[model samples]
Target: MFETVLKCTKCGKEYSLASGIYKCEKCGAPLDVQYDYDSIRDLIEDNDSWFREPPRVWKYWMFYPVSNLRKIVSLNEGGTRLYRMKNLEKKLGFGKLYVKNEGENPTGAFKDRGSSVEITKALEFHAKKVVVASTGNMAASVSAYGSKAGLEVTIVVPEGTPIGKLVQAVVYGAKIKIHGSTYDESLAESERMAREEGYYLTGNYHYRVEGQKSTGFEIFDQLRFDSPDWIVVPIGAGTHLRAIWKAAKEFYELGLIEKLPKIAGAQIEGYDAIVRAWKERKPITPIKEKKPTVASAIAVKAPVDGENVIKAIDESEGYLGAVTNEETMEAGMMLGKEGLFVEPSSATALALAKTMREEGIIDKDESVVIVATGHGLKDIKTWESFIKL
Candidate 1:
């Protein structure tokens, strides 16, 4: 088992493993799940053979902070396919393009990976009820996993959540609460509900970030345990970006990888808080009123973990960029042409990649891995426009 601690990313303060706290008491910044790397290295050395087994994320069980395997409520969330886009590479003239399709997850999005671990942690803490706020994907993931464990589930969603993901949460029997116009408002309500109603809030928790780190683990494994030059992902709350960076650092410390890959984040035009903060070289200020865009999933008015996200980008020598709604839809259509249909937010990765390549920010010789975070089926209504063509 790992000796884990919840450490604040900003203030470097540590909390007990069983503290059940999500943020730092001192600074309010997001906490990271830090492990005893030396112990982890020793374990890997002792059980070297078992590391090659299947079921991707679980293969890295020693990396997770959970003390009891019995408490893990998994739906085989990780181990998604890594697709080599040779045709895309030729078309875009980029070096070694690939797509890590997280849409293959049971709930049709990458949020399942985090929700699986978060729900398990809630069960471990003996919580009877759990709550989450999401644009759509996280709500659905939590609802499904929470229902499987027979825990009461309550979800807060913004008014315009995509119909398909909303339907998933409903069918999973979660009591849905419709909140403010933006995802940020819903999250605010969820936080209040957690404090007053004593519901175990799971979204944006440190353990959830640990679970999402499995995507980085899977990408490394799929690439034969080598580091790519760039790993692009769509940014919402920005936890996934930080999680990927955490996994890479863990791999580097364990001597599994020589260096960390650049962690680039893509956001749609209207929901680019992290990008704006990065460009300004200042703290993030939440957008008061967000504009409408097809990329509903990543349309967060405020990213709670914005500071950590900026730190990850800076530490990894990465950049954050945004694309217009037209560009997002165009990228989604291009993926559809490749027989890979993904949500608009997921397509933003490709949109960023294309932009970087055209602007000469991305070298033609460097390998690139784009993360398609959700399935197009989750936002099937958006695909009707592409179908009309």
Candidate 2:
């Protein structure tokens, strides 16, 4: 196992990996996992055989913070297809366009990637119970993984989460608590439980960010270690976009990729705190009132990783914007036409990509990749209501 340390993202404080702390004690900010990159670079340079292994989350195990291979509780997540949208490319008049379909994971959502790592780390810490707060996807994912690891799982969700998602968690045997009206409230409840009840808190923390970075790794791998011109990702808690940018920088520093791609963040109109902060060049001000939207999965009023996401976008020379529910529905239909059935939240990436291209933020001649985070089936009722089927 390579040497690792937890560094505060806000302050410069560093903690040993053995500390088992997810946030900085000094600044109360999230911590980032830092690895021994020199050894990792040497390992990759010396042996390229691991690259031939089946493309799954564990295929890039070296990049993860987990040291014990046997502790990994995986459902064979990652390695989702990166499909070239030839028809959409021509229709949208882009040089090239692709969709990294994360819906292909075991639990039919991208959250499985983080769950695999989160569960593994929980085991490493000798934790017997795990808790998470989610609008939908993460709850199902963590429940499935926790059940696989033989750990007690508790899920706290906001009111109005899609039934399809909750059913998956129920089937996985997780104790469900419908606590509050919004995701932020549920997150607070979960955190309180973790503090008082010794439950391992699992959500968009640093360890989950480590796992989510695999999406970026797979994208470069499928593209033959090449970086795209723009990579569009939908932001809820803003973890995935930050993770991808971190992955890009890691690969570049390790002498894997020559250049980094511009990261564009997508959000629904009412839940677009990060986008608003980006445009205003200020810190994120939490949204007080939550408005109903089709993209329930991304309806986060107070994004946990908003500041880092803004920093990532600014550093990458990227764009961040919000799209209306109607725009998201149109984008989802467009994806369906191409045989990719994605949830409304996932379609936000495509919606933002269209706007970017139209506004000249993303040039037509540049290669673009839109990350479709979850399957349409994850929110079937939303689709049924809009499609009249």
Candidate 3:
């Protein structure tokens, strides 16, 4: 059995393990699973020798919240390629550049890491079904893994999501609800179903958070260090940003790293919910249906984790930046030229870094890491418009 610890970040209350429900009863904020680290330090000290055994996220199973490895369903998600960019470094004027290429996951996106854990929890609880509201990447990831776990799956996506991702959800046989002019629109629609159907919601699930934290573990393992100088991530619903922050903070607390890296949150200007919250020092005003952008994947009008995401940014002293549709497209093309064909939303990071370079916000000599969240092929239909060849 796992240490199976659970704690409320809001109310300092603890809940029974395997509650089959995730929210804190007292405060209603999401619960984070706690693990006993008395044994973890010695166990993970020889990180390289240990990690070479399992190439996937599950390699760090002891650090993750999941208890039973056998019950865990996986698509061999995570352990994505980390590329050092001499080419991108020169262009961006950084001393070092690393791309955590997440497109190679089972569903061709980083969301697979969360999907693997969510499905495992669903199986453990014998959940009636698995459901998630996603723009593009998460819908496809949840549908694909839910299929593997033999769970009844439903995916909610915005109508304007890329055609390829929509088609994947369709062909995967998951019940699909296409709503919202944007990702947050579909999220609202999914919330209704989640409340009525008792399906496990991925974004709101503790297991998903536990599983997604593996990305941070893998990054540390890859760097052979605690963390990098900066980690640039594209944010739609802010769960990933929150997870990255959580993991890095955990590692630092456990003496893994002396310092935590700045978690840079990237957004397309029109769908910049977290950005606005950061600047104004207040809660985000919900916008249901946002206009389209080439960075369609991160185009959520209102992300559910807005408050916690801003807390992560403000507490970490991290900054936020917006990349325009034109800048996003250009950055995507530049990545393609460097042999990285990431989705436009993923390119938002590179664009932000470039903009930061101009402003001298980020020093040229610091090591920077960019998270490329999905495969470019998901939005291939729009690629012809920007492709140089």
RMSD of 1: 1.6
Candidate 3: misplaced stretches above 4 Å?
A: 1-5, 8-13, 22-28, 45-48, 51-55, 157-164, 177-189
- Each candidate structure's TM-score, on Cα atoms with residue i matched to residue i, is 0.96, 0.97, 0.90
Q: For model 1, which pairs clash?
A: none
lDDT of 3 by residue, 118-231 (tens): 888777777768778864677778888888888778888776555656678767668877777765567777767777888877664667777888778778878875588888
Q: Model 2 over residues 148-221: C-alpha lDDT tens digits?
A: 99999999988876666688899998998888987778889999888899999999899999899999998988
Which of the numbered candidates is closest to the native, going by highest lDDT? 2
RMSD of each: 1.6, 1.4, 2.6
Using TM-score as the yardstick, the better of models 2 and 3 is: 2
- Stretches > 4 Å off in candidate 1: 158-165, 179-182, 386-389
Per-residue alpha-carbon lDDT of candidate 1 for residues 1-389, written as tens digits (9 for 90 to 100): 68567888889999998887768899988888777889888888888676577646678887887779877888878889999988889999888999999999999999888888888888888989998887488888999999998899998888976566678888988998889987668888998888888899979879889889999988987887789999999998899988999889998888888878998999898788889889988778887775888887888877877888888988999989999999989988888788898988899999999999999889999899999999988888777765663
Please list the C-alpha lDDT of all candidates, in the order they appear.
0.86, 0.90, 0.79
**Candidate that beats the other on TM-score, 1 or 2, i.e. the better one:** 2
Ranking by TM-score: 2, 1, 3
